[model samples]
Target: MPMVPLLICDDSNMVRKQLLRALPSGWGVSVTMAANGMQALEAIRQGLGHVVLLDLTMPEMDGYQVLAAIRAQGLSAKVIVISGDVQAEAVRRVLELGALAFLKKPTDPQALHKVLLDQGLLDPSQQTVAVSRAVAEPVTSFQDAFRETINVAMGRAAALLARVLGVFVQLPLPNVSFLEVGELHMALADAQGNAQLTAVCQGYIGGGIAGEALLLFHGSEIADMAQLMQRNSADYSDMEMLLDLSTILIGACLSGIAEQIDVVFSQGHPQVLGMQAGIDELIRVNQTRWKKTLAVEISYSLEGHNIHFDLLLLFTEDSVERLSRKLAYLMS
Candidate 1:
């Protein structure tokens, strides 16, 4: 039998490059590409591939429409919807529409490969449990203690950001959960749409304890931020102001966490990007680098004011594992 063929349908060339890089090396399969749903359908009609990696937003036709079309034609190929638009309703709809699984953009290569294997589309023998039984009894005391510790560390980060901006900043206690990269994107998008600006930063924590952190901000409240920074109005453009604010917020947040945890850390400068771009562009940009997405969302409020913004921190698999280990140690 001929080796199976896979089709990758996405609008961005960058994302295509990343996906190609992330896929397992020896899957005995060939890959094809399509820029939109219409092209994907044509490729399928031609009997081109056995698997389709579909993107949700495209210029000509969206992923949902293509999925419906595929089902209508009774095409037997499996589809996996890969996107950064993480609304619960969207996930629910796609599942109902017959998409086999959903992977967020910047997907982890290992996770994606495992999903493929689990579906029997690939020959790998990896198995993932949806829910694992706890090996030890629940420790409520340590859980509460660590939660409080993280809260204080986050607060200190907020205060540092406020000092840098010369405004009062509020860092809300986050609702913690184990999140994949796609789910993190959804949460950030929901928050970003409601806020003015968002800033993102990535870095590791340590002193023998290490992990990653992300910071976000609201762009609309530039005036307040400028006031806090003690900078004159003529000093910055909208984008420049946002970048500067990110540098400060990220720096402070990381520094604060280090102090509270008694862990030492160093950071890289912020790489500022627009989060309000169209979903297609965002997916395209991220797909160039990451295979799996692991991120954290932190919300910030300006003290004595209604101004609020979101912070998103992204990490690679290595970083995530390191953080998980640290969290486990702290809880223990």
Candidate 2:
């Protein structure tokens, strides 16, 4: 092959750079970059993407949309999806939509290399420049690195939940922000809308990282959740369903993050913050306890179902520097 035209599509700058560095050293390819699906489609249209590496959760257009477009437009781009969303449905859907393969997040270089070789995209004997400089370059900042970390953790959580519920989880682009108590209230309002909500809060502390995990469920959706969980009406109540969900999502998500940053956390007992309360009421009860926080929000929806919930990871302001140091060490 003279040169393969490859496109790397992901919203994270860190992820894009990592993929570039992960390319086979001797692969003969001209690489194009896209931050979202629209750009990826445009690049393919321009003949810049004979091969596309796609990430699933992105703003504007997601990987699923890109795959659909590639099929609809009769484009010849061979798409290999790379995403943190590891749900079984996610993999099945990508393949069904015309993706050549699906790889999990925080990609393995050897695995990627093997895939390329197996797919005849690489020649085993070829030798090219090493990615030493790319290796040396750390992620741009703590925020970007932290957000990407959450992105991966979010997927792990969703995957577990999807497995337990036997439903496809629709993932959102994680929302990360540093906010004051007032701003946090506003953000919660936007997330929950006017729905009455029930929430569970759990605190975790270790390795100089301390925060609370809050899982919010819409009041009207608890019955839907109960149905999906296949709960015995005589055996489980709405509150039981809520706590169970909190345990699965919050535990898996925190464990995922901890595994990446090399931290071990001791978790506090889950507290029922409120049931059938408005967003304002929920925040008011906790307002005095939080001043400033680093908040990571993930809204997960069940495919073909009306069930949706928001999981918020709130790190204390004091924990930011310690977490930053941890990420810096990991990236380094």
Cα RMSD, each candidate: 17.6, 3.2
lDDT of the candidates, in the order given: 0.61, 0.84
- 10 residues in a row with least lDDT, candidate 1: 126-135
| Structural RMSD, model 2 | 3.2
**lDDT winner among the candidates?**
2
Model 2: residues >4 Å from true position, as ranges? 128-139, 185-195, 233-235, 275-289, 329-332
Candidate with best TM-score: 2
User: Cα deviation in Å at residue 75, candidate 2?
Assistant: 1.5
Clashes of each: 17, 0
Error of 2 at 164 (Å): 0.7
TM-score per model over all chains: 0.45, 0.90
